[model samples]
Target: TSSPTLTFNDGNTIPQLGYGVWQVEDDVAEKVVRQAFEAGFRHIDTAKIYGNEAGVGRAIASSGLSAEDIFITTKLWNADQGYESTLEAFEASMDRLGLETLDLYLIHWQQPKQEKYVDTWKALIELKKRGRVKSIGVSNFTKEGLQHIIDETGVVPAINQVELHPFFNQSELREFNASKGILTQAWSPLGQGGELLESATIAEIAAKHDATPAQVVIAWHLAIGNVVIPKSVTESRIRENFAALDVTLDATDVEAINGLDRGAEGRIGPDPAVSD
Candidate 1:
């Protein structure tokens, strides 16, 4: 009953179902992350912008799990999107996380307007070459941005984490990522636990499968093959979301959820193309 995993193009595998700590306070992140571990999540997604990497590191230290037992992913913030700056930021992040080697490191945003992601990606490629990080990838990158990096360096990203949910599935982007062997990771898989969770369709599907609306939505994400990271500060909710690994949806159910896509209107986060 553990979380499933997906392999990156580089041959590294990531847990498909991970616990995310986006808005959790730094002081509280350690407690909730510990709760997530106890609930059986082995992968944790965090970012420098999230401001909880130190607490996350504390939980990892206290969990009694070896470094290889967990998959830890952290991202480089937008402001640090240059060659030397990215390297410095990685060192600072490592100092905060208390880790010698990182599981994955990502360019948190393309920040295309800044016109530095190409060089930023080179730094990540260099990190991978030096074995500082096991895998390197990007987040909030559009297809154009992804192509630009790949064309510039001849290296494809291993993953692309973005805001994805039933409401804003990003089917076209997902297809493009798949075409290039980049695994798509969902940042807001539950749509911030608002209207999407309250949808009549999700409620009906949840009742049909004897699952919570959150689990149903998560299962839908799994069915469509996106790595999902759902965050919750409450212990009970954390455990409940992890149990989504057990929720199985039929083809009909998957089709019904797929029908919920709201196209561009459903996006809840900043558009990567214009974010910075």
Candidate 2:
């Protein structure tokens, strides 16, 4: 039941396995989150755009777990990508989450077209100094986008969350993050659904370990030093997702899974660095 952990640039450690709430309904998000907590997940990832922060807050408050025992992460949306507006948006997110401070806060998108992400990064840096957020990072940022923020602020983000899975390993961006000491957090780490889970290659590996295909893939992510947050509303699935930490994939198995990467990405989500 021991989950892996990684130390961030800010000297804080985050559990490698996290429960992500991307499209879960607010009403269901709380119950599902509670299930995840009870299942031994210490990290929870949410976003302002998810519209479930209040529900997530309720679950965290009622979990009977001390706040210090959890690593909670939330993100700011695109429209809030500026200094003052980002500050206000951060406040709104904190209020919704019912937390005085966050373990980590991230920019949900790069939105370079808006040309305000640098200003947003500056605001996040100030937020860190103000002690409102422990660490700051970005999501959907390309290497160039991350470098832009670093060049302007002179502060490297603690993480960069992006779309990652066995199908799209993101080698170059991952190398870039590793070189900069930024953690690469994977959203949709399982792909859109159970498609990859049903693959014969994954199934064979799962059989060898007496584990599920999903768990096999998650172990692959962990072996590669990537952070993974797999979302699910089903209580059983939540429990199963947490069990991924227990399944260790061998190098040969990892290589077999790594072979699945297309080099070209099968990204189900938009590239927010360029999207509207």
Could you give candidate 2's per-residue lDDT for residues 114-186 as a string of tens digits?
8988999999999999999999999999999999989998999999999999888898899999999999999
Q: Name the runs in model 1 displaced over 4 angstroms.
A: none
Alpha-carbon shift of residue 216 in model 2 (angstroms): 0.5
- Residue-level lDDT for 241 in candidate 1: 96
Give me the runs in candidate 2 sitting further than 4 Å from their true place: none
Q: Evaluate model 2: give its lDDT.
A: 0.91
lDDT of 1: 0.94
Leading candidate by lDDT: 1
